[model samples]
Target chain A: MLDIKNLHVKLEEEDKVILKGVDLKIEPGSVHAIMGPNGSGKSTLSYVLSGRAGYEVTDGSVTLDDVDILDMEPEERAAAGLFLAFQYPVEIPGVGNMTFLRTAVNAQRKARGQDEMSAAEFLKVIREKAKTLQIDADMLKRPVNVGFSGGEKKRNEILQMAMLEPKMCILDETDSGLDVDAMKLVSEGVNALRDAGRSFLVITHYQRLLDHIKPDVVHIMSDGRLIKSGGPELALEVEQNGYADLKADAGAV
Target chain B: MARADLKKEKHEATEARISTLNMPQGGTWASMARNEALSRLRGMGLPARRDEYWKYTRPDTLIQQDAPAAALFDSLEPAVFDSVDRLKIVFVDGVFDAAASDDLSLSGVEIDRLETAAAADIHWAKDVYGRLEARGQTPVARPLAALNSAYATDGILIRVTGKAAKPISLIYTHKSEASDAILHHVIKLEKGAELTVLENGPAASRFNKVMEVEVADGAKFHHIRAQGRDHERRAATHLFTRLGSESLFKSFTLTVNGALTRNEAVIEFSGDNAVAHIAGAAMGDGAFHHDDTVFITHDAVNCESRQVYKKVLRNGAVGVFQGKILVKEGAQKTDGYQISQALLLDDDSQFLAKPELEIYADDVACSHGSTTGAIDQDALYYLRSRGVTKKEATDLLVLSFMAEAVEEIEDESLREEIVTRLTGWLERRSG
Candidate 1:
C-alpha cells in the first residue's frame, strides 16, 4: 500500500542529510514497526510521508497505492487516504474538536464525490466513536487538542484516524509521553481499526507499545538507514539488547 | 489667501457665538448637563491633528461649516421598503417622517420622535437627552458632543415601561440629496424594562450624526447599527449609554460600506452589578476609512464589561480601533476585557489598533489585547489544498475571524442576515 525508494531528505538551511537513501515498502493487511534510537529520522520519515513543508527531498520518490504522493500537498495527501498521527498535535483554539473532525471527514467525502453527513447523523457517528475511545461528549465539544493531556491528545489523533478511515496511517512516536495504561488504550484504539485492506507504520522508541498491537515486520533504523529487517522477534531482541549493537553493525556495514 | 483667512475668521466667530449661548435649562440635571457640555466644548474644540485619538480620523472635513441649529423639517418622500420585514422610521434631512411612521403601538412603551417629546414633556427631554460626561478626565474629549448638543433638532425617543416584552426598532433613515444631515436619538429604558433597538442609516446618503442613550435599573438594552453611506459621504455617530444598577447593555455596530465613518460608543456602568458587551465589525475597501473608538467604565463594584472589535481592510482602505477600559478605585471585582483584531488583505491597506486598560482598583481583573496580521498562510494553503478556490478559502478565514463578534449577536435571523451581507461584500471585493 506504500512505497519509498532511495529517499534522501536534508535540512534546507544547513543541507544536513536526515534520511539517507532509505527504502521501504509495506503491503496491505500488515503492520510495520520502525524502531530506532534518538535522531534516527523516524519522525522525519513520517513528516516526509505526510508531505509537511520545509523538508528538502533531494532524492527519491514516494507512492501511495501506486499514486505518486511527493507532488501532493499535506491536505491533498490526507484526502488521498494517507493519515499522519502527529507526535505533537496542534492546538487550534476556538475550533471545536467535533467541528474540526466533521470538516475533515466531509472534506474527504466531498473529494470522493460522496454525500455530506447531516448534523444528526454526524452526532450519532461521533457519539459511537467517542464511546469506543472513552472520550466524553463534552471533550468533543471543546477546542481541538486545546488543554488536552498528552495521552488525551494521542487518543484524539487516533479518533481522527478512525473517523477518516485512511488506507494508510503513520503513527509517529504515538507512545512517547503516554503512561502504560494510556499506551494500552491508544494501542487498542489503533488495533480496533485494523483491517485486511488497511496498513500502519508504527514508529516508537520503546517496545512496550508493540506488545499491545503486534507488528508483522520490525525494522531497526541506525544512522538514517534501515540497517536490520527481521520478523517480529527482532523487536524483542532490540528490547533486551538495545540499539547500541545495531548502531555498531550499521557503522561496520 | 485673504478670502480664505476671512472665511476662517467668520467661522471662528460663529463658533464662539454658538458656544456662549446657554443650553435650554429647566430641570435639576439640565443645568449641570448644560454646564458640563459648555465646559467640554470650551476645553476642546473640534478634534484636530493635536489630539492623538482623533489623529487618524480628522474631523476637519466634517466641521467644514457649522450645521444649522434645526434640520429641514419639511416632510420627506416615502421610504423604499420592499424586501425587509422591519417597521421603518424614516428621517429626512434629520427630521422624523410622521406620515410614514407606523403606529403599531407596543404595550407599556412610548415610542415618539425626540422633537415631539421635547415639545410635550420638558422634564423627560432634559433628563434623558444630551448627557455626555465621562467619569475621569474624559480621555477622547469629544468636541462633536457640543455640536450635537447645540444643533440636534429631532431624533427618536424610546421609553420602555417596566419589563416590556416587545422590542422597539428605531430605524433612522437619512434621505437627503443636497445638504448635510444630522440626526440625534435619545433612548431611555425605564427601570426593569427590556428593549431591542435597531438603527440603520440610509445606504447611499451624505453627512449624518447621532447621539446619546439612557438606560435605567435592571433594564436590558440591545442596539445594532449599520452604515452603508456613499463613497463620497462622511458620517459621525456618538452613542453614550448610561447604565443603572444590574442593567444589561449590549451593542453591535457594523460598518460594511462607507467613505469615511467614525463611531464612538461610551458605556458607563454607573451602578453595581451592571454588565455590558460591545462588539463591532467593519469592512473597508476602495479607499474607504472606518474608525471605531470605545470607552467602557466600571464605576461600581461587581460590574463587568467586554469589548471586541474586528476589521477587514482591502484595496487602499484604512481601519482603526481605539478601545479603553477604565476601572475606578472602589470598583472591586470588576472584570473588564478588550480585544481588537484586524486583517489587511492588500499591501496598500492599513490597520491601527490601540487597546488600553486603565485600572485604579486593586482587586480588578482587566486585560486588553490587539493583533494585526494578514491571513494565516498555512490555514489558507490547507483550505486551498482541499479543492476550495482561493477566494473561497480567503472568505472562509475572514468569516472565521469575524465569527466571534457575529456570534455575540443573539438575534438568530439578524445574525444570519449580517453574515450573508458580509459574505456578499467579500465576494464583491475579492472579485
Candidate 2:
C-alpha cells in the first residue's frame, strides 16, 4: 500500500546528502523489516516520508495508496494514514497525554470530513487500548511523556499507534531503548493490530525485534540502498553472524 | 533666574493638574491625611517620562486633564464571580449607586461607604483611610496613589472580625466614555479573622484606584480581582497591605486588554512568622500596554514572601514588571522568592522587567529571576503533528506558560473560573 521510488534526501541546512537513490515498495497486509547498519539512511528515510521539516527531498516521491504525501503538511500526512512511532518520542511538559490523543484523533477526523469523536467515546476507546499496551490511567492522564521511564515512553508510542490505527505504520528503531519485556509488550501490541489492510515497515539495527514481530520480508540496507531482499531467514543470517560480510556483499552488489 | 523661573512654571503646571480633582472631605483624621497627601503630590507632581521608576512606562495618558474616550466593552458572558453568591457593591461611573447595591448587611463584617464614613461623626476606618498610601510614598514616589488619596471620594470601608460567610465583591460599571473614576477602599481584619475580597469590571474610561488593607495577628486575607476588558482604558491602581504576626495574605490579579494599565502593590510584614504571596497574570493584544510594579518588605523574624507575575503579549503589545523584595536587619531566616516571565507570541511584542532584592539579614534565602521567550518550536511541532491546528497549538502553549501563576490562587473553584476565562480569551484570539 506504500511505495517509495528512487528517493533522495539531504539536510536542508547543509549540502550533505543522507539518502541516495533508495527504492522500496510494501504490499498490502505484509510486514516488511528494513535492517541497516549505522548511518545507512534508515531514520532519514522515515523522516522524509513523515514530512518532517528541515529535510530537503532532492528527488523521488513517496505515496500512500496512490496519494502523494511529500507535498502535504506534517499534519496532513498524519491525516493521510501515516504513523511514525518515533525513535525518541517528544516530551511535552503541560499537554496531557489524553488531551493530545483526543486532539490528534479529532483533527484527523476533521480533515477527513468525519464527525468529531466525543470525549466520552474517546475515553472509553483509549482506556481499552491502553490496557492492552500495559498503560495505566495515570500514564494517559499525565503530560505526554514528560517523566516517563524509557520503557514507558516506547509503550506510550505503541498506545498512540493503536489509537491512530493508521493504514501504514513506520517504527524507526523502536527497540533501541526498550527492555526485553518492553519489546514483548510492544510486539504483542503490534501483533494485535495486524490485519489484512494495514501494513508495517519496521526499521531496526538488531534482528531480535524481528524475532518477536516476524517480518514477512527482510531487506538488508547499507549506504542508503537495499542490496538484498529475502524472507525471514535473512534476519536470522544477519543475527547469527554480523553485517561485516553483508557489508562487503552489499558493496559488491 | 532662568532655573528659578523653570521650577516655578513646573510647579504651576503640577498645581493645575491637582486643582482639577476634588478632595474628599472627611472629619478630622481624614482631612489631615488628605492635606498631607496633597502636599506630597505638590512636591512629587505627576510622574514624568524621565523619572527613574517610570522609565519603562509613560504616565502622561493617566495624568491628562480629561479622561480619554474608550469604547464601551459589551461582553456576552456574565461578569466574573456573578454565579458565586457574594455581597455586591455596585459603582456607576465612579459614583456609588445605592439603588443597585445590596444592603450593607453581612455577618461577621461591618461595611460603610468611604464618602459617608469620612462624613460620619464616628468610624474606625479613619485610622487606615490613607495611612498605608502615605507610608508607601517613601523609597519610591507613587504620586498617582497619593493623588487618589487626596481626591478619591467614593469606595467601601470593610472591617472583619471573624470568618466571613461569603466573598465581598466590588462591581464597577460604566456608561459614560469620558468618566474618570477615583476610588480608595480601606479594609481591616481583626485578630484571628479571615476574609476574601473580589473586584471586577472596567470602572470607567480613565480610572485611578487604591486599596489599603491591614491584617491583625493570625488573621488571613484573600483577594482576587479582574481588571476589566475595556480596550482603550487608561487605569492606574495600587494595593497596600500590612501583615501582623502569624498572619497570611494572598492576592491575584487578572488584567486584560487596555490602552494603558499600571498595577502597583506594596506589602509589609510587621510581625514574626507571617506569610505573603502576590501573583498576577496579564494578557494584552494590539496597542495595549500593561505594567506591574511591586515592592515587598520582610521586617519580622522567620517571615516568607513570594511574588509571581506572568504576561502574554501579542500584536505589538507591551508589558512591564518591576518587583523588589527587601529583608530587614535582624529578620533572620527570612524566605523570599520572585519570578517574572513573559511569552511573546510575535516578533513585535515587548516585555520589560526590573527585579531587585535587598537583604541585610545574615541567614536569609532570597532568589529572583526574570525571563522573556517565545513558544518552544519543538513543542509547537509536537502538538501540530498530533493534529492540533497551528492556532490551537499556540493558544495551548501560551495557556501552559501562564498556568504556573494561575495555579497560585488558593480557592479551587475561583481558580477554575479564572482558568476558563483565560481559555476563553485565548479562544477568541485564535479564532
Candidate 3:
C-alpha cells in the first residue's frame, strides 16, 4: 500500500544529507519493520513522509496507494489516510484530549465530505475505543498529553490510530519509552487493528517489540540506505549479533 | 511650546470641556460631589499623549466631547445572561429605559436609580458618589472617571443586606448613532452579604462608565462584564472597589472587538484578611485598540490579591496592559500575584505591557510578570498533523491562551457563556 523510491533528503538549515537514494515498498496488509542504528535516516524518512517542514526533499518520491503525498500539507496527508505515531507525543496544554480527538476525526471527515460525528456519537465510540486501550474518563478529560506517563502517551497514540483508522500507519520508535507490559499492551492494540487493507511500518532500534507484533518483512537501513532485505529471521540475526557487521558488510560505516 | 506651556494649554482645553457639561440639579450632597469632581478634573485635565499612563494608548478619542459615529452591531447570539434568572436593568443610549427593565424589586437588596438618589434630600449614595473616584486620583489621574462622575446622567445605586436571591444583570443596547453616554453606579455590600453583578453592553457610540463597590466585613461580591462587539465603538470604563476585613471580591471582564476600549480598575484592600482577584480576557482584530489599566492596593495584613490579564491580537490590532500591585506599610503577610500575557497572531499586531510592584511591608510576598509570545510552532504542527487545519489549530491555541483568565469566573454557566461567545468571535474572525 506504500511505496518509496530513491528518496534523498537533507537538512534545510544546513547542507547535510540525511537520506541518500533510499527505497522500499510495502504490500497491502503486510507489516514491515525498518531497523537501523542512530543517524541512519529511519526517523527522517518517516518525517518526510508526514510532510514535516525544514527537511528538504532533495530527490525522490513517496506514494500511498499510488497517490502522490509529497505536495500535500501535513493535514492534507493526514486527510489522505497517512498516520505517524510520533516518538514523543507533544504536550498540548489547555486543550482537552477528547476535544482534540473529536476535532481531528471531524476535520478529516469534513475534508473527505463525510457527515461529521455528533457529540453523543463521538462520546459513545470514544468510550468504547478507550475501554480497550485502558484510557479512563479522566484521561480523556485531561489536557492533551499534559502530565501523561510514557505508557499513557503511547496508548493515547494507539487510541488515535484506532479512531482515525488510517490506511497506512508509521510508528516512529513507538516502543522506545514503553515498559514491558506497556509494550505488550501497545502491540496488542496494533495487532488487533491489523486487517487485509491496512499496512504498518514499525520503525525501531530494538527487536523486542517485533516479538509481540511480528513483522512480515524486515529491512536493515544503514547510512541512509536500506541495503539488506529479508524475512522475519533477519531481525533475529541482528538481535543476536547487532548491526556492526551488517554496516561493515554494506560499507556504510 | 515648552512642556509647562503645553501642560497649561491642555488643562485649558479640559476646562473648556468641563465648563460645557450639562450639570444635574440635585440634592446638596450630590451637587457637592459633582462640583468637587469638576474642580479635580479641571486640575488634572484630560489625559495627554505625553502622560506616562497614556503613552501606549492615546486618550484623544476618549477625552473628546463628540463621540464618533458607530453602527450598532446586530449580534446573532443572545445576551450572555439571557438564560439566567436575573433582574434585568436595560439602558438605551445610556438612559435607563424603565419600560424595558424589570421593577427595582429584589429581596435582601435595595436598588434605586442614580437619578432618583440625586433628586432626594437625603440618601445613602451621597456617601459614595465620586468618593472612590476622588480616592483613586492619587499616584495617577483618572480624569475620565472624574469626568464620568461630574456629568454622568444615569446609573444604579445598590445595597445588599443579605445574599441576593437572583443575579442583577445590567444590559446596555445601542439606540443613537453618535451618542456620547456616561453612566455611574454605586454598590454597597453590608457585612456578611453576598451579591453577583453581570453586565453586557454596547453602551453607546462612545461610552464612559464608572462603577464603585464597597464590600463590608465578610461580604462577598462578584462581577462579570462582557464589553460588546460594536466594531466602531469607543469606550472608557472604570471599576473602583474597597474590601473590608474577611471580605471577598472578584471581577472578570471579556472584551471583544471595538475601535477603542480602555478598561481601568482601581481596588483597595482596606481591612485585613480580605481576598480579591481581577482578571480579563480580550480579543482584538484589525482596527481594534484595547487597553487595560489596573491598580490594586494591599493596605491590610493577610490580604491576598491577584491580577491576571490575557489578550489576543491579530492583523494590526493593538493591546496595552498597565498593572501594578502596591503593599502598604504594616501590611505584613500580604500576598499579591500579577500576570499579563499577550498572543500576537501576526507580525503586524502589537502588545505593550508595563507591570509594577511596590511594597513597603517587610513580610509581604508580591510577584508580577508580563509575557508576549507567538503561537508555539511545535504545538501548532502537532495539532495540524492530527488533521486539524492550521486555522482551527490556531483558534484552539488562542482560546487556550485565554482560558486561564476566563476560569477566574466563579459561575459555571457564566464561564461557559463567555467561552461560547469567545468561540463565536474566533470563528467570525477566522472566517
Candidate 4:
C-alpha cells in the first residue's frame, strides 16, 4: 500500500545528506517495523513521506496505492490518507483538544468531498473513541497537549489516528516516552484499527513495543539505507546483538 | 527652534484650536470646570509628533481643527450587544436621540443627560465632570481628554446606588461624512454597588470620548466596549477611573477596522486592597493604526492591577502600546502585571511597544512583557499536518493569540460575542 524508491534527501539549508538511496515497500493489511541506531535517518524517512518542510528531496518518489504524494502540501497529503504520528506532539496553548480533532476530521472529510459530521454526531463518536483511549471529558476540553502527561499525549495521538482513519500510518517513535502501561494501551489502540486495507510503518529503537503490536516484517536500517530485511525474527536478532554487528555484516556483503 | 519657542508655538496651536470651539453654556460649577479644563489643555498643549508619548502614533489628524471626511462603512453584521437585554442609549453622530433611546429611568440607578445635568443649579455630575480628567493629567499630559471635557456636546451620566439589573448600552451610529463628535460620560458607583457598561460603534468621522468612573468602597464596575468596524474612521478615547478601598474594576475593549484609533486608560487605586484589570484586543489591516496607552497607579497597600493587550496586524497595519505601572511609597504588597503582544501576519505590518515600571515601594511585585512575532511555524505545521487548511490553521492561531486578552471579559456571553466578532474579522480577510 506504500512504496518508496531510491529516496534521496538533504537538509534544505545545508548540504548535509540525511536519507541517502533508501527504498522500501509495504503491502496492504501488513505491519512493518524499521529499527535502526541513532542518526540512521529513520525519522527523516518518515518526515520526507509526510511532506514536512526543511527537507529537500534530491531524488526519489513516494507513493500511496500507486498515487504520488510527494508534490502535495502537508494538508493535501493528510487528506489523501497519509498520517504521521509525531514523536513529540505539539502543545498548542489555546486550541482545545476536542476542537482540534473536530476541525481535523471535518477538514479531511471536506477535502474528500464528503459531508461534514454534525456536532452532536461528532460528540457521540468522540466520546466512544475517547473511552477506549481513557481520555476524559476534561482532557478533551483542555488546550491541546498543554500540561498533558507522556501517556496522555501518546493516547491522544492514537485517538487522532483512530479518528482520521488514514490508509497508511507512520508511527515515529510513538513509544519513545510512553510507560509500560501506556505502550500496551497505545499498542492495543493500534491493534484494534488493523483492517485489511490499512497499513502501518512502525519506527522504533526497541523491541519491547513490537512485542505488543507484533509486526509482520522487520528491516534493519543502517547509514541511511535498509541493509537487512527479514521476518519478525530479525527484530529479535537486532534486539539481542545490536546494530554494530549488522553494520559490519552489511559492509562485508 | 529653541525649546521656549517650540513650547510657545505648541501653545499657540492649542489656542487656535480652542478659539474655533464654542463651549456650551452651563451652570456655575459646570462652567467653572470647563474653564479649568480649557486652561489645563492650554498648558499641556495638543499632542505633537515630537512628544515622547506620541512618537509611535501621529496626532495630526486627531488634533486638527476640521474633522477629516470618512465614507460611511456599510456593515451587514448586527450591532454588538444587540442580543442582550439592556437600557439602550442611541446616539447618531454624537447627538443623543431620545426617540431611539429608552426612558431615563431604572431601578437602583439614576440616569441623566450631561446637557441637562450641567444646566441645573446643583447636580451630582458637577463633582465628577472634569475632576478625574484633571487628576489624570499629572506625570503625563492627555490634552485630548481635557479638550473633550471642555467642549463635549452631550453624554450620559449614570449614578448607581445598588446592583443594576441590566447593563446600560451606549450605541453610536455614524451618518454624516464630516461629523466631528465629542462625548464625555461620568459614572458614580456608591459603596457596595455594582454596574456594567457596554459601548459600541463608530460615533462619527472623528470621535473624541472620555469616560470618568468613580468606584466607591467595595463597589464593582465592569465595562466592555467595541470600537466599530469603520475602515476610514478616526477616534481618540480616554478612560479615567479611581478605585476606593476594596473596590473592583474590570474593562475590556475589542477594536477592528479603523484608520486611526488611540485608546488610553488611567486607573488609580486610592484605598487599600483594590483590584483592577484592563485588557484589549485589536485587529488592523492595511491603512490601520491602533494604539493602546495605559497607566495604572498603586497608591494604597496590597492592591493588584493587570494590563493585557493583543493586536493582530497585516498589510502595513501599525499597532502601538505604551503601558506603565507605578507603585507609590507605602504601597507595599502591590502586585502588578502587564503584557502587550502583537501578531504580525506579514512583513509589512509593525508593532511598537513601550512598557515601564516605576516603583517607590521595595516590597512590590511588578512585571511587564512585550513581544512582536509572526505565526509559530511549528504550531502551524502541526495543525496543517492534521488536515486543516493553512488558512484555517492560521485563523485558529490568530484567535489563540488574542484569546488571552479576550478572556479578561467577566461575562461569558460578552466573551463569546467578542470571539464571534474576531472570527468574523478573520474569515472576512481569509480570502
Q: TM-score: which candidate is best?
A: 4
Quality of model 3 by C-alpha lDDT: 0.92
Off by over 4 Å in 3: B1-3
Compare the candidates by lDDT and give the number of the best one. 4
What ranking emerges by lDDT with the best candidate at the front? 4, 3, 2, 1
C-alpha lDDT of candidate 1 relative to the true structure: 0.75
CA lDDT of each prediction against the hidden true structure: 0.75, 0.89, 0.92, 0.93
Q: What fraction of the native alpha-carbon contacts across the interface, defined at 8 angstroms, is recovered by model 4? A: 0.75
Tens-digit per-residue lDDT, B243-311, candidate 3: 999999999999997899999999999999999999999999899999999999888999999999999
**Where does model 4 sit among the CAPRI classes?**
high
Model 4 vs truth, CA RMSD: 1.3
Clashing pairs in 3: none
Q: Which structure among the candidates has the greatest DockQ?
A: 4
Question: What is the RMSD of candidate 3?
Answer: 1.7
In model 2 chain B, which range of ten residues has the least summed lDDT?
B1-10
TM-score of chain A for candidate 4?
0.98
What's the TM for chain B in candidate 2? 0.97
Colliding pairs, model 2: none
TM-score of each: 0.84, 0.93, 0.97, 0.98
Q: lDDT tens string, model 4, B109-178?
A: 9999999999987899887889999999989999999999999999999999999999999999899999
